[model samples]
Target: MATQLPVINLMGPTASGKTALACELYARGNYELISVDSALVYQDMDIGTAKPTKEEQQLYPHHLIDIITPLEVYSAAEFVTDATALIDQIHARGKTPILVGGTMLYFKALLEGLSDHLPSADIHVRADIEQQAAEQGWESVYAELQRVDPQAAIKFKPSDKQRIIRALEVYRLTGEPITQLQAKQVKNQPYSYAFQNYALLPDRAELHARIELRLQKMWKIGFLNEVEFLMEKYDLNDNLPAARSVGYRQALDFLQKSDRSLKNKAVMEEKSLFATRQLAKRQYTWLRSLQQTHQFNVYLSIEQAQEDLRNLYG
Candidate 1:
C-alpha cells in the first residue's frame, strides 16, 4: 500500500519566521515548501517583499514563487489548483508537502474549499469605479453600489475601495449582485490531505517592536527603490492589490513627496512603521478568526510547533 504523506502548514503574521521554520524542516528532508503567498508569486518583486534569496531557493526548491508577473493577477482558486497537483506529485515521490505562508485567505481557500463560482475581475468596470471614486469619493461609490447591491453595501464600508469596486464590477458583468451569486456557489473538494498547522506569534510588546524594526529594515533595504522599480517595471498603481501592501503605500507616499508636512525622513518612517503595525494587527485578527472558524490547531513558537509535531506524527 502506498503511504499517504501528510502536509504540514506553517502560518503566521509577517516577520513571524514562517520561512525560517519551513527552511529548517526542508533542510531535514521529507518536505517541499509550497508558497501560499499572493505577493511572492509575482516576479521582479524580490527584496522589498522579503522573498527568499536565490541561495535560499537553491537550498530547497520552492514552488509557486515567481510563477507569474506583477502584471498578471493571481488568485486563491488558481493557487489551490496548482498547489494540489504539486503536492500529489511530491507524495508520489515519497516526500511530504509543506505549505507555508502568511496569507490567511489563501490558506482558508486551500483547506475549507471556497465556492468554485468566484467572482472574476472586470478591469474596465473596476477602472470606471476607481475613476468615479477619485472624482466623487468613496461615499458616492458606495451609494452607486447600494443601488445595485444593498446587501453587499451593508457588508462593505465606504472606504473599502477594493471590495466596493469588485462589487460594482460583479454587478456590471452579471447584472446581479455578487453577494447573491456567491451565496449560490457550491462548495466542492478537489483533494484531501492531513494538515498540520501552526501560527507563530511573539509577545504583544515583542511583536510591536519587531514590526517597527522590520519596517525600518525594509526602508533601509531600498523599499522605496523597490516600489519605484515596480512602478517603472509594471503597470501598477495605487488601486492594485500590490500597491496597497504594507510599506509599499507609505513608500509611495514618501516617494511622491506627499508627506510635505513632515520635516524629516524619520517622521515618514514612523508613519510607515505605524501603518505596518496596524497591518500586522489586521493580519493577526484575520488569522485568529480563521482559527476560530475552521478549528485548525495553532502553535505560538517553533518549539511549541515541534512539540505538536512530535505528538501528531511521532
Candidate 2:
C-alpha cells in the first residue's frame, strides 16, 4: 500500500515565528508554501499584514497572498476552495504543501470542509446591512444580531463590523440563526493526505513583548504611511475588511481625524497593541480547540520541532 501524501499545517498566534519556521522548511526543498492568512490576501497590504517582502516571495513563493483587492471579501469557503486546489497542484508536482498562518477559521475550513448547504454571501444583503451600519452605527446592527443570534453576537465585539455584518446577513438571508446553521453543518473532511499539524505556543510575556516591539517597528517603518496610501487610493473606510485589520484600523482611525490634537500616537499604539493581544487570545482559544496537533514553544523548542519535521517527512 502506498503512503498518503503529507500536508504540513504550521499554526501560531501573531508574532509566534511561524513564518520564519515555514521559510526555513521551504529553503530545505520539497515544499511549496501556501499562506492561510486573511490579511495577506489583500494586495498592497504588506506592512500592516507583515507580508513576506517581494524579495522574500521571489526567493520562496507563497501562494494565495495578494490574491484579492482590499475592498473585496475573502471568506473561509473561498480559502478552502483555493487552498484545496493549491494542495492538489503541489502534491501533483511531488512537493509537500506547507500551509502556514494565524487564520484559524481558514485552517479549520480547509481541513474540515465547509457545509455545502450553507448559503453563499449575498452582495445585495451585505450592502443593505452596510448601509444600515453606516446610517445607524454598527452598534445598532450588533444589537439586531444579538436579538437574532445572541450566541454568535456574544462571540464578537459590537465594533467587529465585518463579523457582525456577516452574522446579520446570514440571519437576514436564511431566516435562521447563524450559530444554529453552523451547528447543523455536517463535518466534511476533504483531504486525502494526512496532516502533520504543529502550533507554536510561545510564553505569554515573551509573545506580548514581541507584539509590542513589532508594532513599534511597524510604526517606525512607515506602517501608517502604507495605511494612508491605501486610504487615499482605495477610499478605504472602517467598514472595509482591510481597514478593520488590527494595526491598520488604528492607523486609519488616527489618519481620519481632522483634529491632530485629538490624535494621540500613544493611544493609537496602545489600542493596536491591545487589539493584537486580544487577537492572540482568540488564537490561543482556537489552538486549544484543535485536536491531535503537536504543540511547541517556538522560542525554546524550534530546533526540536525542526528535527521532528525532518523525521516525519525526511
Q: What would the TM-scores of all predictions be?
A: 0.89, 0.88
Candidate 2 residue spans exceeding 4 A from truth: 121-143, 150-163, 261-263, 292-303, 310-314
lDDT of 1 by residue, 261-313 (tens): 54656677777778767767867887887777554666666577766665554
The segments of candidate 1 whose C-alpha lies over 4 angstroms from its true place after superposition are 1-5, 188-190, 257-264, 310-314
- Which tens-of-lDDT digit does each residue in 74-150 have in candidate 2? 88899988998999999999999999999999988876777765677776788799898789988788889989998
Q: Which ten residues in a row have the lowest lDDT in candidate 1?
A: 185-194
Q: For candidate 2, give the lDDT.
A: 0.84
Candidate 2 vs. true structure, TM-score: 0.88
